[model samples]
Target: MILKDIRNIYHSELDALFGKEEVDSFFNVLIEHYLNLKRIHLVLDPQYMITKEEEQPLFEALTHLKSQKPIQYILGETEFYGLPFKVNEHTLIPRPETEELVDWIINCHTERSQIVSKEPQTKILDIGTGTGCIAISLAKHLLNTKVSALDVSEEALVIAQQNAELNVVNVEFIHDDILNSRQTELVSVFHKYDVIVSNPPYVRNLEKAEIQPNVLDNEPHLALFVDDENPLQFYKAICEFAQINLKANGMLYFEINEYLGAEMIALLEGYGFKNIELKKDLYGKDRMVKGVK
Candidate 1:
């Protein structure tokens, strides 16, 4: 079928499900993934024909899209921090706000390096590392940093390991539950890190209504949510761990639920973390928080 026809069908079927703008984005991404054609190629060659073999997968993808499956899951991969990451139902698809967290970390380290007049070989840890996006991105961008990532799910650790390798970054992947009492023992094997970061399960169960069906139905809830009664459970655990595991003057970073910025600041302060900063994402939501021990 011709590209224009495929585009029309995509819009007709998906516009209702995802809206016209998102459908256009889906079409562009799908065409690029399947045909290795850029968006310009579609516009320049409106009559570009897709082979029967290619059409089969495109049709399958459209069906999945119509069912409210995320396009990243349909594609089985996504780009984050300019690196390719393999994702599955076992892993949470990395989001753009998380990329802002990565950028913030990088910029902070870059500024520190300039002040020190040398790039210190900093050790960094990412707790609840799902898909290893944060760990790998920091490893890739901060060349002087050694990175380690931890996840409770073995399946998530497997995907995270694959993404680390895919990005050609050396991120240590650990498969231990952070909330377990055994965490201290597991963490002791490694030296204290200069930085510890987590984008852990912060979505309260009460916030489910705000989540889209594609995420609620298809994404892994293990990485997305906490009990409504204890929304900051993961944050508490990580901060406690950081007290012993992070070096003196070490930094802690978290991508948090926008509603809990005040609570997060209070929690960090209660933990004796200093120089706390709450940063807004591109959308101006209080999405990231940092503190120094």
Candidate 2:
């Protein structure tokens, strides 16, 4: 079938299942994923056609989309901070907000370098580095920074390791449950990092009903949530780790639950961290919180 015919059918199929707007969005994403064709390309070509063999994957992908699977998962890869990274059900898809957090770190590193008073080699650790997006991006952008990434899930770490190699960045990846107090392996493997960053599981269980099916059904729940009563559990653990492992005046950055900005700032302050700052995202919601240990 011609590309136009396929898109029309795909849109109609999806629109009946999802909605007209969501179907349109899915169609655009599918075209890009399957044909390496963007919306503009569809407008430009107008008569582009998909071969029979290509049609199989396209139709299969459309089936999953109708089931509400995320396009990134359907494609098996995504761009994070301008770097391509492989993704799957084991890892959460990297978001644009996290990219902003990465940019902030890179800019901070550059500013420190300009003053000629920065550490010779800044060390960084990305806790809960699901796909190693944060760790790998930092290693790629900050040339002299040594990076280590840790995840509890061996499955997630495998994907994270692959992403590191794919991005041509050097990252020391470790597999360990961050929640286990006995897992001193990571605690001792690398002690003093200049910066520790995380985009850990901040979603609460009670909020599950609010999550889109594309995420709640397909993405790793281990990488997505904590008990509703202790929504800040990961943040608290990570802060405590930073206290013991981070160098004096070292920075701690987190992509926090938007609803808990003030509470997170308070938590960091209680940890004796200084220069606590809360920053909002493009949506004007409190999204990032940082503190200097």
Candidate 3:
């Protein structure tokens, strides 16, 4: 089949499930992923033919898309902060907003290095490190940095470890349940970190209706949700852990739920975290919060 015919098929099959623009985007991504051809290439060669073998997987993907499977999961990988990561149902696909969170941390550390005469080797830890996107990105960008990541799910950690190797960064992966453990239980493994970050399960059960079908049906709920009664559960636990594990003047960063910014600030203050700051993502929703120990 020719490029134009395939494009039409994609739109006709997926337009109702996803919008027109998104369907177009998905077709473009599949074309690029399967054929190594860009959208402009398709436009330039509208008569470009795809073999039966090549068309089979694209059709399968269309069926998956019709069932509301996320394109990232369909592809089994994604790019985050300019680095590639392997993702599966075991891990939450990294989002653009989380990339902004990584950028904020990298920029902050870069500025701090400029102010100091010599940049000290920094130890960084990422909690609930699904896919190891934040930890690996920080390690990839920052110089003289030692990065470690922790997650309760061993399945998620396996994918995270693969991502770290794929990105050629050395990130220590630990299997620990942060919610069930005490500070003393972690002290032996986690001595001190100059920067601690987590993009934990901030989406509450009540927010299920707000989530897209692709995420609600396919993604790991353990990494995506919190109890509605106590929405700040992970944030509170991590903050308390940071109190004992973070070095003096260490930084804590979180990608948060937009609705609970005020509650996040209050929780941080209550935990004795200083210099708290809230930042919005590209869409202007309050998505990131930072505090200092």
Clashes of each: 0, 0, 0
Candidate order (lDDT): 1, 3, 2
Candidate 2 Cα lDDT to native = 0.87
Give a tens-digit lDDT track for model 2, residues 152-248: 8898899999998898889998877667757834565546989999999998888888899888889999888888888988888888788888999
Listed per candidate, the RMSD to the true structure in angstroms reads 1.5, 2.0, 1.5
Cα lDDT computed for each candidate against the true fold: 0.91, 0.87, 0.91
Candidate 1 regions exceeding 4 Å error are: 118-120
lDDT of 1 by residue, 1-293 (tens): 89889889999988988799999899889888888889999778888898899898889999999899999999999999889999999999999999999999999998898888765689999999999999999999986888988888999999999888888889988888888857655775657899999999999998999999999999999999999999999899889899988999999999999999999999999999999999999999999999999
Residue by residue across 1-293, what tens digits does model 3's lDDT show?
Answer: 88789889888888887889999899989989988889899778879998999998899998899999999999999999999999999999999999999999999999999899677789998999999999999999999999989998999999999998898989988888778766336643636899999999999888899999889999999999999999998998898888888999999999999999999999999999899999999999999999999
Global fold similarity of model 2 (TM-score): 0.93
> How many clashing pairs does model 2 include?
0
User: lDDT score, residue 230, model 3?
Assistant: 91
In model 1, where is the ten-residue run with the lowest total lDDT?
A: 181-190
